[model samples]
Target: MTKPENTGYDYDVVISGASLAGSAAATLLARRGVRVALLERHSAPETYKVLCTHSLQACAYPVLDELGLVADIEKSGAVHNQARWYTRWGWIEPRAAPTGPALPFGYNIRRSTLDPLIRSRAAETPGVDLLLGHQVTGLIEEGGRAVGVTASTPRGERRIRARLVVGADGKDSAVAKFAKVPVRESENTRFAYLAHFRNLPLPGGMSHTWFLEPDMAYAFVNDDGVTVVAVLPDKRRLPAFREDLEGSFLEFVRALPEAPPIDSAERTTKIIGTVNYPLLSREPTAPGVALIGDAALTGDPLWGVGCGWALETAKWLAEAVAPAAAGRGDLDRALELYARRHRRRLRGHQLLAADFAKARPFNPMEQLVFAAAARDAAMARHMYRFASRLIGPRRFLNPAALARAAAVNIRYHRIASRTARRPHKVA
Candidate 1:
């Protein structure tokens, strides 16, 4: 382990990252009167990576509401609505499915805007100390347990000792690295390129996703008249993309027939790309530390599950670990329960996402269901429920739905075969 330059230890809970998961955890823990220190590598509170599409699905809204952020987010002009998915077959429309009274749909907010808002709120909460410009360089170990973090800042090296150390540092978490936790890689097929565009005419009040067989694209209307556009392609094509990110990204989105017409729109930011970052997780908890957000697990962005998962994990860990942190019970046992609950709640979603990311052209079953929805409003509603995460994969893939999907696939294939045998029609 690399030693930090300066070291003076203090604090009850030290968090190594100050992004979504770290900030959320700090807010909740501080509100409960637990002394918290949030450390971030960046000096500017406004500094945030502009990588995500920034769409928060409905599954995450409840967690946000519980954090007292829903109203603030809405006031910040976040878009709230179900996104419309356009496949080769047809459009999957939105439907209203109630999870609870206080929650109102999903939201789309720029991470650049949202990150600072969250961090500011966390700083204001009592019992929390926000330390910017501090980079965590090593973990402080006491008797083989992670008791704190050693970080370097402008003032030099300092050690923040705590009963618990939380690693919310994201996918490439240094905490995860230092702990020597094992990560199991999945078979990842898709690579993504994302950018923001201005003067793009998006479907009013709803986001859009176009599934073009092996390729997928999406656009969301976020705050500041900006639309977040992303293209997800097979991993083999990533090399060409890396060479000329902007050109390749535009071409990919333009090729999707269902994507918004953006030929005239101007790219407001440089295109960003991520390739082969497959969703994986080790044990999220060990000894005196716990991992949340992308540190715990990273799923396919195709579903826009990252932010929601981050918030959810923060809430779960906050509730699970608070009592133990307060000395009411064994902290180790609390972390074990947190790990079990986190896995149990998210295992189904992670498994499905991993399988889907293989990027095989949609199988017959998928075609059937999508085709059925094109022809039937009721089927579309069912599909919407699944897409919005109101229903699990098992319920969505029940016998009746599967049978209909299979029948549709067989019929579509026969038609395609006949069409291939015929002369090409003039446009």
Candidate 2:
């Protein structure tokens, strides 16, 4: 609970969280000569949330590359490539389709290994005063504008004043709550159970996911001799899952058509579960405060989009607010621009994510696409690009794409109908 000395308040921006988005913003802004105070409640640099499956998609690769951490991340146990999605119909293998470039793949790396690296990088940046173990209990307002934070630690309470306060806290952000920001809650109720295992034999260096009707499961293979596995189920089933997490998690994974390798692998970490309550802020910015990462918007984890979105938001906000924080433009104006840009860039994806989180079984069209992708290499590749988030959902669901998918579906159904007529062999 140790806190930095109260050396009086002076910083261009005071970031209230020290995880992914906050650290990224702190690093970028501080490197640009903007004085930053990066605060976190956790004292241990190695401490990280173990609930996430820790999969970063291709959409985030460019952001990491810009931060100059892509190489370092790759070296620190990142497994590259897209995933093989096992549908009830068939396995959708990776292939090239007619959507944009060959989908650039990304990696899977545990946060236990990734968060500390990024936090350390932020601490090393020249203009950032990294303050760990300090919990911001309240905000200091001046003329209706948030100008500083009042934090408490073992040393005592202290006020660190700054022109701007950034809330990079994760979903369920205390900063957002304290600021009384309006939040729009989605009714989609899903929960996730995650764990890590060693010696799981998976296909390629790729991650894998199973869209098993009402239940969704994922497996992420990292380079550190382990794979992360997770089960996401509708909230209605949460009671049974909570009764026996480890047993229920294993049972769920084993029930998938293409069962995960967890049964064969040795469990390396204790199972963790989190109730999924996807949320997004109605306003990402107020007078002198702004939110980023999950604090701004927490979409469903089914898409594995959280980490990428966090990095993307940090980069976007950094670029948008740099001139303002440096006194070249109005800070409020810059924050408004950041908010608009975030909505424009991610609204469509968020809508899609919320719709998918309902846990409803995939419709006929979805089944057709999965079945076709399993049989056609070209189709699989196109599907890969969409699944990797290279293309927006609109483009992926275009009329032409649907028509092609329909043709494939007809072929598969016809074959199945004929086979059913002659199916008399006992297994």
Candidate 3:
């Protein structure tokens, strides 16, 4: 672990934190022949983020396939799932569309397995220097622009320089902090609690989510016969959860209509919880520096979009900066393009996610749409697209779509009223 001697502008990009975002960016940049320094605090390759729900939504499938990791992941017994949403009105099951190219299905695998898989691919890439056990302590700035970083490692303190520095770190990012980036946060109204269970009598590889008024619960059937069950309740219910976590978790699960038979299942892991996780957004780009994944935007975990966003933002970064890093374009202009791309893709989604994180009851329009989705197959497809993040909030809630949903709801209520008034024939 001795400090290297030739450390002058050693790499094209020095990425902080070797999580999904950092590793993915390193792989993409390296494959394009750009030198990359990937810094990770965890020395072991197998170590992973333990609190993850381990769900990858369909939106990330193209990136996974492009990275050539999907086949290996499936071989490791990942579950391919389609989500079924349960509302108080009824259950809405979205069928895979029959049109242009089959829609992608989501995958569920433990973080213990998935994280190492991607990191191994990255470390083996041609020009990526995997600097394990390196913790970023501060940013190296020149002329008001980040040029490199100072990190503490087993060897000692070392300085590494690069043309661009990427903060692919998590919500509390050291690189972002050192660079003095501005972050805006919105208060979270609910807290999440979850655990893995075995032998929970549920359908195969299907995600079931129950929207019970203001509270929400989900059971995702995952690999190796394990199911991840999670609940999100308002902060006002914290006392009930703190009293007896196990007992209260069971009580809530049991209360759901047609709930999974968790009582017969064995708990495979200790209950884990995350409290007060606010919706966070930050300026994603600065001169000679950029942020991706949770470092850019951290939304509510109840939506399960974190992993997908991590992969997506990394790919976007590579598309924007790799050419410049390889000496084909201007670095400053590339960073600006990346910033605009980030907002175009995620800004609307982030705003909607922040509002939903408030845990408010469904509004009149939402109720109408949900009821229509339950009764109509076509409407369900729209709901699925929006939930999967395939479509933005503005497109999903357009005037034409809202008018159609209202009409469908009116038709459904008229049919129900007529059926109730009809007399039963005597046998």
Please tell me which predicted candidate would have the highest lDDT against the true structure: 3
Candidate 2 per-residue C-alpha lDDT over 246-301 given as tens digits, one digit per residue, 9 for 90 to 100: 78888888877757657779998888777856656457888889899899888787
lDDT of each: 0.81, 0.81, 0.87
Which segments of model 1 are wrong by more than 4 Å? 1-9, 97-104, 239-244, 400-427
Task: Give one digit per residue, the lDDT tens place, for model 3 in 1-427.
Answer: 2232354677889999787889999999888878899999889988798887688888888778878899998998998868889997899888855675555676888888889999999888888888999999988899999989999999999998888999999999888888888999988899989999998877555889988768889998888888999999888888989999999899999988788998999999999988789988999988788999999999788888889899999999999899897667899999988899989989999887788778888888789889888988778988888887788888889998888898998898899899999999999
TM-score of candidate 1 relative to the true fold: 0.87
lDDT of 1 by residue, 1-427 (tens): 1122222436667898888889999998877767788999999999875778697777778878877888889888898856778877778775543552332367889998889988998898887889999998999998999988899999999877888899999989899988877887787788888888888887664788888767778888888778888889888888898888878887888777655677898888878767866878678998898999999898888888888788888888988888777556789998998999898877788887888888877776677788777655557777876766667778888998877766656776788799999998899
Error of 1 at 263 (Å): 2.1
C-alpha RMSD for every candidate: 5.5, 3.9, 2.1
Q: Flag clash pairs in model 2.
A: 95-381, 96-381, 97-382
For candidate 3, the 10 contiguous residues with the lowest summed lDDT are: 1-10
Q: Which candidate would rank higher by TM-score, 2 or 3?
A: 3
lDDT of 3: 0.87
Off by over 4 Å in 2: 1-9, 96-102, 364-372, 410-427
